[model samples]
Target: MSPAVSPPDARLPHRDARRDAVVDELRRLMARVEGVPKGREGALSFGLSALDQHLPQGGLAFGTVHEISTASEADLPAAFGFLLALLARTPGSAPLLLVLASKKLARCGLPHGAGLAALGLAPSRLTLVETENAAEALWATEEAVRARAPAAVASAIGGKLDLKASQRLHYAAREAGVPLLLLRPGETESVATAATRWRIGAAPGAQDRFGLLAGWRWHANLERCRNGEPRAWMLEFDHATHRFSLAAAVADPSLARGGEAPSLRRTG
Candidate 1:
């Protein structure tokens, strides 16, 4: 006679014991493979050289949930600056959906596509979605995440996301494997469901201001790294040639491991 089966649980479903055994065996067989699968991470490269180095494989992972929050107002750029660069490099830049709850982007246009059309990104690729409230915006943002084909999804929503909603979006983001750029509001101390959490602080400007000092600074911190610590760093975005790179600000022998660079840096 066949083995008797049990009923399913309310919270967690129960499957047949024999079926579970088969799944366990299959998992073990797969674990002994030569190497882990080199799954496709969304092609989200940073236009800035300095910023990409800190991310996974020169960019954020396509399949992971990334939370971007700011500790201070001045540091807000680090969170969105990276997103701007990612959008510029994401494949097929048109139809970029920007679901924003807060009015940061509404008030302050994206630096890449603002003041003038000099930047390569035309007005068409930049689509903005402003909702009536945070709840509506979050729903729309989740929908955008499911649409995954966009270069990137940047949403500046209020810091009132419930855990269940976050989990749903996180699952969708992981499944779709799209780069979700969430702009967490300032002074938010709530928990986040992100594979990586980074806090960015703007450094000084990169070029001379008519008759002033030069260069912009950014302090990036990998607050939560489910992967690994990797490396935490600050960068200098050189505007003369329009290139972003690691800062050589300190030269105390220990931190000067990169050696001397040419007098002038070439930017793109």
Candidate 2:
């Protein structure tokens, strides 16, 4: 087998000094053994074979944290749509963990069921922990990361996240090695401690006599990364095939680019 990147040898919290040492060592090993290369050098496909070919390492870092948010309802479609494709790629046969900070929103299930049907995590296989508060949700996220059985863990939370809570979640996710996706509102702009932070927008899809059909679009204005940084691309998510195909520059008119505009079917 490929050599193990994380030894499973190091213990948690690593006696203070050892903590940074351990994180450093983990980064060193990740450089050598990682499935996802740092930065835009890789395409960041969600595990679709057709999708993987163009991307570096064929998929994203299995357990790293990737932050996501939209500026307004106008942008929510793209953000949520990108997430669906992401979840579609991540739902390996292993149980998946999804912690919903907006249980009342109910949009959490798009990926939980209909979207990721092909990824091996049926709705039944998904374990969702619902909470009303950020602090409480962060606690459960830590537990999920420790479990490590889930192929991925995601949280759809609105508004700014507490810096300390973000850091705690980062370390927990680091130990478990489960990739994380957090959904935040547009107005909220707390600097993320995650491996990478991204923004998503909506794209106008094909339309008939009906109103314009819009697809989800994504951009990578990475706030932080261990790898290289590249200019952002507004990606297109094709719902029919559950694929995240790339598009050119950042101009898609289907989605009103403004953060305050609303654009979504009331599936929630």
lDDT of each: 0.59, 0.57
Candidate 2 residue 66 C-alpha distance from true site, Å: 1.1
Tens digit of lDDT per residue, candidate 2, span 197-267? 56666555533357654444555333344453322444665555655555534334334243232322211
Full-model lDDT, candidate 2: 0.57
The reply for model 1, stretches above 4 Å from the true place, is 1-39, 47-54, 103-112, 115-121, 208-215, 240-242, 250-268
Report the backbone clash tally of model 2: 9
Question: In model 1, what is the error at residue 165, expressed in angstroms?
Answer: 1.5
TM-score for candidate 1, residues paired by index: 0.67
- TM-score (all chains, Cα) for each model: 0.67, 0.63
- Model 2 CA lDDT for position 46: 57
After TM-score superposition, the amount by which residue 108's alpha carbon in candidate 1 deviates from its true location, in angstroms, is: 5.8
What's the CA error at residue 258 for candidate 1, in Å?
17
